[model samples]
Target: MTAADFQIDDREGGSVLRLTGDWTTTGLGSGARDLQARLGEGRVTALDVSELGRFDTAGALTLVQATTEALPKDAWASRPEAGRIYAMVETLERQSAPPPRRPDALTRTFAKIGRGVFDIGHEMLLSMAFLGRLTTATGGALRRPGSIRWPAWFSQGERAGLDAMPIVAVTNFFIGAVIAFLGANLLTQFGAGVFTVQLVAVATLRELAVLITAILLAGRSASSFAAEIGSMRMNQEVDAMQVMGVNPFQALVIPRLAAMIIMLPLLTFIGMLAGFLGGMLVTWSQLSYGPSFFIQRISEDPMMGTHLMVGMVKAPVFAVVIAAIGCRQGMSVAGDVESLGRRVTAAVVQAIFAIILLDAVFALIFLELNL
Candidate 1:
């Protein structure tokens, strides 16, 4: 390869660089070092690479290494050609690597178990810390309830309740229909078709409604809480609050948690009603069961109230879990968009897991009580 000819000149805001002919390793290195030196002196902000040149990997590597090393870590590079340099490096790194060794089945199983235990421990510790902080802040707020921010509570309520109603309504309606259809099909075979009404009512009021509502709140409200708080963290708003002598947990977390705790029960109730109505439609229209007969069957079932009560009780607990997980994950977020994304995802996953675990606990308690 022939040596490249290049020219550097002062521009209106930064340096202008032009290249001509073929770029040899030495020529490329010289040009890259010069640019690096200019950047070190804080004199260069842009480069003009539009001039004619025939370059190989050495030339590309020189540009890539210089750009990567010279610029401030946060500085943006908008060069299209420079992308090729990074891509080539990445491709080479991947292609030159050996295939990963697969673990034996027992090793993989043990690794998974170990990871699960670690994750559970980490989550528990974080949750305990968050709850401790929340309790401290809440006690302080209770001492001066008038000092508690009302606007924040209203905003959170609106977001967690009104904004989430439509989707919750649609989903619960479909879920009710599905349950009724499945029960009707199975029970009809046993000449117990009339029991479908009790099945739909008890299950919808006690389990499906609350569970579905909790999951929706986890996905929608919890994720939103995490993302909002994470953004505040990234923007240093939480630090600013601290500097201003504001309690972030009281101002942020309490309001959100309170809103969720209050609204979730109400939403679950609404979901239960919608689900029951959907089941009623299927039973009365498709199954030819009269509305009176459905209502009578539900009322006559002694265990119906037990299921309803179980579901209703689960709602508040689920809300608490969802809010706590979201707030904890959000507070843990580092100052980056990527960290925010990860924490938001974690919030949803953790909230759902916690909800399911709590439901299981409730189920065991109810079983023990013979309810």
Candidate 2:
């Protein structure tokens, strides 16, 4: 068969190659090689194929191969036909290439941990800035208490506090029971069974109650805060609030921060109570410790009150951490559902890390204080 007739038309600022009639394999290959030479020499910046083109896959592959071999770097190919051909060739090449080597498990885990630490640090810095803004807004509101948005506060409290109680209660109860059981078993072996009461009280009131409650709040309340604020951000509701002469931080963030601040301590208190009860049940049934005996042990323990106070203090700080981290991440969320999910996850993770770190600091302080 005769080769297809074609012509190369050079245009100002670019080059256009027009083809007419059928393109034989020989003609297509030769054309591709010639185009490749021109492209390699930087003589052609753009290729145009708007006229008289009838080409098969072979013809298309010729142009793709030419471009792939000629292009000095990954530059944009503007011609539709060339782009399409390039994409096809790329897909085929990728499929034909060997599978990528997998990283070692330890290496992957450390990489993930490094990323998590970086994310937490970034989130904490942003959270500190958000907290500063919140402090300013709170002081302003205090100057005019009526300026505080009570309705928003109540709504957020209902969502973040009341809605989260069941899970928090269950988790705290189980944690308390587990700690009590473990402590009783170990202490009983050493003939220190009576001290189990003190152990349960100190562990639950000073550490487990605060730690478990903070974790639950981080996962539930903090994530919820991030998601809610992120959704508002994604929907441009935050921007709309600004346009309506309302501060987005005041209207969107203040209420959440307030709700969490007020609610988390209450939640922690409730969790402590539930956990104590769970421990009491274990003590009575498993350890033969009566209610009076347990009560006496707690009252006689010199550090019991101090432990309780420490846990309560930690609750408020943990609440602030969760709320601040959540709101900061939400405010930073981009306008997409995926970003919302990611920020929410990041908020919870960061809040947990902060809570644990803060708890450790408190533990060290109390230890030094002989409490």
RMSD (Å) of each candidate, 1 decimal: 13.2, 10.0
On a 0 to 1 TM-score scale, where does candidate 2 land against the true structure?
0.71
Q: What tens-digit string does per-residue lDDT give for candidate 2 at 1-371?
A: 43554455566765544545444355454544575566453344544444434555566555555454332123323345545655676567546768889999999999999999998697568767877888888788889887789999999999888888888888889888898899889999998887777777888898888789889889988888888889989999999888888887778788988898899888888898888888888999988988888788888877777788988989888888888888888899998788998899888898898898998998898789877
- Runs in model 2 deviating more than 4 A are 1-54, 57-125
For residue 183, what is the lDDT in candidate 1?
Answer: 88
lDDT of 1 by residue, 264-284 (tens): 999998899889888988988
Indicate which candidate wins on lDDT: 1
Q: How many clashes does each candidate structure show, in the order listed?
A: 0, 0
